[model samples]
Target: MVSIAIIGRPNVGKSTLFNRLVGKRLALVDDQPGVTRDRRPGEGRLMDLSFEIVDTAGLENAHSESLSGRMREQTEEAIRIADLSLFMVDVKSGITPEDQDFAEVARRAGGKIVLVANKAEARDSDIGYLDAYALGLGDPVAISAEHGEGMGDLRDALVEALGIEVFDRDAVASDEAIVDVPVPEDDDTPLPYDETKPLRMAIVGRPNAGKSTLVNRMLGEERMLTGPEAGITRDSISVEWEWRGRHFKIFDTAGLRRKARVQEKLEKLSVADALRALKFAEVVVIVLDVTIPFERQDLTIVDLIAREGRAPVIAFNKWDIAEDRQELAKELREKTERLLPQVRGIRTVMISGETGEGLDRLMKAVVDTHRTWNSRVTTAKLNQWLERTIAHHPPPAVSGRRVTIKFMTQVKTRPPTFMLSTTRPEAIGASYSRYIINGLRDSFDLKGVPIRLGLRKPRNPYAAKKKRSS
Candidate 1:
C-alpha cells in the first residue's frame, strides 16, 4: 500500500488535514502550535483511493538533544519510510523562512512530495497560496482541510503523482461493503473470543506515571517521546501490535491530574481525550507508581473507570528500584481491597516499565478481566444461586412486609448488567444490595469488573380491573 506522510512547521493545520483524510478525529488539534509531538498513523481514504497516512510533528529548529529536535527526527523518519509526503503550509499566514527550510528538507528526503496549501477558505489566503510556488515544489494543491474544500483536486493530484494503479480498488470496495452491514440490536449473548478482531486496551494514570515508557517497553522500541517531563504526551496515541498471535490496539494516554489542578485549556483537552479512550477500551490498565500506590487521585481514577463500566486491571509500575518488595506488595494488596471495595479482588501486577518486568502478567490479567467483564450467567443458575443466597440470609422487611426478590436475569454484559424483579424495588436498601452483589460476585467468580444490579417491580395484571371495580 502507498503510505503518505503529512509534515509541516507548527500551526499549519497538518493534523486537521490528516484527520480529514482518515475520516476520524484521531489526532489532537488546537490553536497552540506544536501540540503534536509524535508520529501517528491511520488508514486513509479519498473517494476510491486508499492508503496508509502518517501525521507528523511540526519541523522545528532545535538542538538534537532537545524535545523539539526529537520531534523533528520523528517527522524525518516518517518522511523516510513513507511512499509520499504531504508538505502542508498555512496559506492564511503566507510562506515563511521555516517553510522554505522544511521544503528543502522534504526534497532532500528523496520522496514524492505534494505541497498542500491548507486554510484556503480564508479570503486573505490567496496571496499565501500564490507564495507557495516560490518553494519550488510544483503547483500546490489548494485545500481547506477544516471546511472540506478542494478535496477532489487533491485526490486528482495524488492519482497523477502516485498513479491510480497503486490502489487496490477491489479491496476498498469489499471494505465499504463490510462497513455497510448493520449490527443486530437484540443480540445480547456473550460474545465469543474472535481472534480476527484486535483487543482495544488503554493504559492511563496520573502524570509522570511511566505510561509512555510502559508502552515503549511493550513495543520493544522508542515509539513514544519520553523523559522526566510531566505531560509529555498530549494526545491519546493508539498503536497496533500482535502478542502471542492475538492482535491488540494499545492506546497510551496523557497523564491525568486532579480536577482542581487542571487549569489550562490544553490540559483539559488532553484529559477529555484520555477519558474517551477509557470509555471505548475493552480493558483499561491503571498504571500506579509503586512507591506511592493508591493515592486519592488514583482511587478517583479507578472509581471513574468503574462508573464508566470499563474492565480494569491495576499495574503497580516502577518495581525495579523499589525496596522491601514483599512488604510493599502486601501493603498494596491490602490497600487495593480496602480502598476499592467496589471492584473487589481486582487484579494487580507489579511491573517495571523501564525494564520490561511483569509485562506478561499484566497482559494476562487484562485478558482475564475483559473475559470476566463479558461473562454472563444462565437464568437457571442465577435463580438457583439467588434462592440459596436468600435462604442463607433473606432480605430484611420494610414496613413489616418482607421484600421478596422473585426473579433475576442478566440484561447485558460488558460490565455485566442484571435485572431483578422484586416485590418492592424501592424498599431494597444499600446494605442488602451490597450483600446480593457480593454473593453474585463470589458465586459467579465475577471479580475485577463492575456488576450492575437493577431492581424493578413486576407489572400487575389486575391493575385495570381493580381500578374499574373501585
Candidate 2:
C-alpha cells in the first residue's frame, strides 16, 4: 500500500489537513503550539486508492533536550519512509522559518510533494498562494481543511501527485445495492460465538447513548432495524453475524434504565434483556457515546456485567465529531475505573459507526478480550493462583468461624465459570465473592468482562467423624 506523510512545522494545521485527507482524527489536534508528539498512522481509502497515511510529529527547532526536538526527529524519520508527502502551511500565519527548514528536509528526501495552504476560507489564500513560491515547493494547493472548502482541488492534487487511480465513482455508494459486512465463520468462532454458546453482551447506558446504533452496526443489512427514538428497541432481538471468520449469535438488547425508575413494563423488559445478554454473551461490548463517554447508565451496565458473570468491552462511539478527544478519553478511562472498580482493566475502544472509524480496533480488542474470557487455569495453576491470592488477603471470619475456601476449579469456558469449594458457601458474603471474582478478573487480565465463580458449601467435614462416634 502507498504510504503518505503530512510533514510541516508546528501549529501549521498539519494535523487538521491530515484529518481532512484520511477522514479520521487519528492525529490529535489542538490550538496550542505542539500538542501531538506521536507518529499516529491510519489506514484509509481515497476514491479507488487504498493507502496507509502517517500523521507525523510536527517539525521543530527546539533544543535537543526538549520534547519538540524529539518530535522533529520522529517526523524526519517518517518523511524518509514515505512514498509521497503533503506539506501543509497555515495561510493565516504565513511562512515561518520552521516551514522553510522542513520544506528543505522534504525536498532533500526527493519524495513526491503536494504543498497545501490551509485556512484559505477567508481570502482564499490571497497572500499564502503568493508566499508559497518562496518555499521552492512549486504551486501550493489552497483549501480550508476545517470547513471542507476547495476539496475538489485537493483531491485533484492528490491524484496528480500520488498517481491515485480513479475508480467507478459509484464504487462504495449504497443508493443502488447495499453493502454487507462478512460474517464470522464457525471454525473461527471462539468460545462465545458458537451456536449453542450464548454470546452474552450487555447493551447498557443512560437514556439515549446510541446503544441501539451499536446493535444495528453489528447486525447490518436487512431483517433488522434500530435507531435513537427513545426505547424504540422494546425487546431484546437475538441476531447472528459472522465476525472475522467466527460465528456469533448476538442479542440486540434494549436501552437499560436505572433501578429506581424502572417501573415501566418496557423499561423492565429492556433491563431484563440486557441482563440476559450479559449472561449469554461470551463477550459484551458496552456502548457509550463520545459526547457523553461515561454516565450513570454506563456505570449500571458495568455493574450488571459484573453481576451477571460476562465479559465486557466498552464501545466509545460517535468519535467522528468529538471535541476535546484527549480529555474525553482520559475522563472516560478514569470514570470507568471509579464507577466499576471491580473490573478496573476492562478494555475501552473509541469508534464511530457514522464514519466507520476505529471499527478495526474495536473488533481486534473484542477478539483479544474474548480470549482472556475463555482462558482456563489448570487444576495446578488455578490452585497456585488461588493459593497466592488467599495468602495475600485471606477470606474474613463470619460468626466466629473463619471461612476457608479449600480449592477452586474452572468448570466452564464461556464467561470462565469457576467453582470455589469452601467450608460454608452460605456464609460467603456478596462483598467476599466479589473479592475472588475481582481478583480473577484483575490478576488474569480478564478486564471489562465477567468472570463467574460458583460458591458451593463443602459437605459437612465433621459429619463422617461424628457418625462413626455415634
Candidate 3:
C-alpha cells in the first residue's frame, strides 16, 4: 500500500507528518528549511492499513547545483511511483509563488492529489484552505500535526481517494503453536541420512583467516583450493563429511568487508553467494580469527545472522598461534558485550578449525542455540510474568490516564518474536522493552538469540490484549 507521498515547498511539517505516520523517527526533522535532501521510503500503518510511505525533499526552481539535480530526479521518481499524493501547504504562511510553481509540477504527474493544510492548530486555516481550492486539486483537509488534530478528515480523504475500507485486527487468542518444541518423535536416534541429502555447514570469516586449510583438514584431502592470499576461495564450495553417527555438509564462503570499502568485482559476487547459502542453511557457524575476532566486519556478519533470523554459533578458530588462551577468552566476552549488543548471550566457543581442537564444543553449541531459537513460552507463565512486570512498573500514564497492558504471548519463534497489544505503543520506553527481553533471557534461559517485541494497537479502547496464530 505504499502509494502516498508528502510534498510541499519547505518546512510545512512534511517530515513531522512522515515521522508520525511511520511511528518511528526514520527521517530527520529540524526547524531549518530543506532539511530533507532526497526521497526516503518507510513502512507505515494507518490503523489497519499497512502501506509504504515516501517523504521527499522540498521542490525548488530548476537549478544547476549537483545536490539539487539529484533531489529533483529523486522527487520525479517518487511521483511516478505514487498512486496518490498528499500536497501539503503551510496554513500559517499561506500559499507563496514557490507553492504555485510546485503545484503545476505536481499536476503534470496526473495523479490524484489530497490537499493538506498543516499548522492549522491554534490559528484559522480559511486563507490557506481557500487558496488550495484555486489549485483545482480538490477539497483540502486542515491538520495540526503537533496536536494531532483533524486526523479523521485526513483519514476520510484517504478512504475516498484510495477507495479503501477500514478494518481492525482480529482479537482471537491463538493457542495452537504452544505445542512443545518438536524433537525426533518415536525415533530418538537420528536415522542415517540419505546419500544424496547432505548435511550442509557454512564456514565464514574475514580474509586470510585459514578458511581453506580448515576445510582441507576436515576432508583429509586437498579437494578445495588453499592459498596464503586473501579471497582465494571465491565461490561457495560445499564438502560432505560424517561426524560420529551424524552426516554433515559444510559451505566455505568469501569474506565480507566493512561495507563501504567493498568496491571489488569478484568479492561482491562472492559475498552475495555466501549470503544466499546462509539463507538456505538450517544452521550457520560464523568463524573468526583469534587474533582479531569480532571486528566491525565480523559484527556485521553476526548481526546479519539475527537480521536473517537464523540459528548462529560463533567459533573462534586459529587458536593454536594465540599468545594466551585464558586471557584471550576473557577479552572476547568483553568485546561481545561492548560491540554486538543486540544478540546478547550468544555462545562463543574457542576452537582450532585447522587442528580439529575444540570442534566438539562448536558442534554442541550449535545444537543448543538451535533448540533455544525454536523455544516458546506457555500462556500461564507468560501472563504471570506480564502481571508481575506490569504490577512492578505499570505502563506509564499519559494525559492523566494510566494505560493497561492486559495480555501477551510469543507470537512466533524463528528468533523468538513476541507481540504486546497495548493502548499506545508509543509510550513503551526502550529501557522497559530491554527489561522484558532481559527478563525472558534470564528467566527462560533463552540466551544468545534475538528476541523481537512487536507493539500493536489495542483491540478495545479499554483492554488491548495480545495473541497470535503462527
Candidate 4:
C-alpha cells in the first residue's frame, strides 16, 4: 500500500493531517484557505502503518487558468502519484514565501519527503520549528495536526522514510486466506452473491448535476475536479472502480443544494458530506442535468434516494447538449413515471458526461439496480406471493373485521425487507401498504429497489391469561 501525499501551502493542517491519518472525518475541514479543492483517497493507519493516504489540494502558485490553477494541478498530481510526501508546514505560520515555493514544488516532484512541522502545539511553535531547516525537506516532523500531538514523531518520520520492510504485517497476512461461509440457519436462505464484493456506488445530484462529470466519465481519469463550477464537489470522493468484473466503491457526491441554499459553513459541510454519501450507498446514481431534467432539486434528490433505502440509478447528464432528443427522451420517460412513483421501475440512463454517451447504459442501470437491491424471496415464494396477493385484492374490511394477512417473510436484503403476520397491525392502511408493495414489486422482479413492508400482530396467546384474569 505505501501511497502517502498530504503536501503543503494553504491552511497548513493539510485537512487536519488528513483527518488524522484517515480515522475519517474525510477531508473538508474549514479554517478556510481553499477549503481543500480535490484529491482525496483514504485507508490509512499509523501505529502498524497501513498505507494509501492522499488528501491534497492546498499547494497553490496559481494562474495557469485559475481556480487556483486547478488546485495546483491537483497538488501536482498528488505529488506525482505519492509514495510518501507529507510536507505540511504551518509551525504556527513561520516558514512562508508559500513555504519556500511549495518546498521547491515538493523538490521538483520526486517523492519521499516527510517534513511535517504542523501547529506543533504552538508556543509560537518554536520559530516555526526552527524555521523548518530552511526548506531543505528533512528534519521536521514536529506535528500537532490539531492536538493529536506529535503522533509518535509522525510515526517516527514514517518509519524513517518508508523502511520497516514497507510495513510487512506478517507478509501481508500470509498473502490472504480466510473462507468461512456457512450461514444459512434458514431465514429463507438466499444470501450468496459475492462476486468478489465491492459495489458500494453513490453519485447523487442537484447543483451542476454532472456529478463530477459522471465521476470523470467513470474514472477514465482527471479523477474528479471538473469546473464551470457550481459546487465544485466539496468531498465525498471514494473511487476504486472496475465494472465488467464487478468490484466498485464509487461515491462522488456533494452538489445537493436546497436546504435554503445551504447557508454556508462550507455549504453545511457540503450537505453533510452529501448525506454521508447517501447513507453509505449500496446503489444510487441520480446525476441528471440534461438541460435541467427533473429539478425541484431533482425531485428532492429522488425523494432522498427513496428515503435512503438506496438502489437508484437515473443519470441523464448532458446528453451531448440536448434539444428535443427524441422528444426529450419521451418527456423524460413521462416525467419518470409521473415524478418517481417511489422508484417504480426507476432506471433511466441517456448520458454524455462530456461525451462518453450513455456510459454503458449507466453501468447497466447500476448492475440492474444492484441485482434488484440484493433480492431474496422464497419463504415459499413469499407464501406463494401472499396467496395470489390475497386472492387478487383482499385485506379491506377493517372494523367490520376482514383484515387477515396471517404471514409473509423476507425480513431482510439490502432494501428487500418484509415481515407481515397481521390480524390487525392497526389495519395496515396506506392503501393496503401500496397493495403489498405493489405485489412485492410485481411478484418479485422487484424493480429498481426500495421495498420494506413491516406489519406485525399475531401475539395474543390468550393475552397473558386475559391479563391475569383482569
**Maximum-TM-score candidate:** 1
- Whichever of 2 and 3 has more TM-score, that candidate is 3
Whole-structure CA lDDT of model 2: 0.69
lDDT of 3 by residue, 397-417 (tens): 778877767677776666777
Q: Cα RMSD (Å) between model 3 and the true structure?
A: 19.4
Better of 2 and 3 by lDDT: 3
Q: Which ten residues in a row have the lowest lDDT in candidate 2?
A: 173-182
Q: What TM-scores do the predictions have? A: 0.93, 0.50, 0.54, 0.37
lDDT ranking of the models: 1, 4, 3, 2
180-248, model 1: which lDDT tens digit per residue? 122232444555765566688999999999999999999998889888888989888889888888899
Clash count, one per candidate? 0, 19, 7, 0
Residue 242 of model 2 has an lDDT of 73
Where in model 3 is the C-alpha error above 4 Å? 1-200, 461-470
lDDT of each: 0.89, 0.69, 0.72, 0.81
Per-residue lDDT for 290-338 in model 2, tens only? 7765567677677777676566788888888998889888988887777
Q: For model 2, state the Cα shift of residue 40 in Å.
A: 41
Candidate number of the best lDDT:
1
True-structure lDDT of candidate 1:
0.89
lDDT of 1 at 148: 96
Which portions of model 2 miss their true places by more than 4 Å?
A: 1-207, 215-228, 259-280, 394-405, 421-436, 454-462
Give per-residue CA lDDT, model 4, range 1-470, as digits (tens): 77888878888888887887767687888887888788988877766777778888788777878778987897898889888888888888788898998898789877889888888887778998898899898789787877788788888888888887886343222111122232242657786766667778888888787888778877898878888868888888888889788778888888887898788799899889878877877788888887878779889888888877878888888888888799989899888988888878888989988878889888988887888888788788788878888898888896688878887887677788788998788878888898789878977789867787888887888989988999
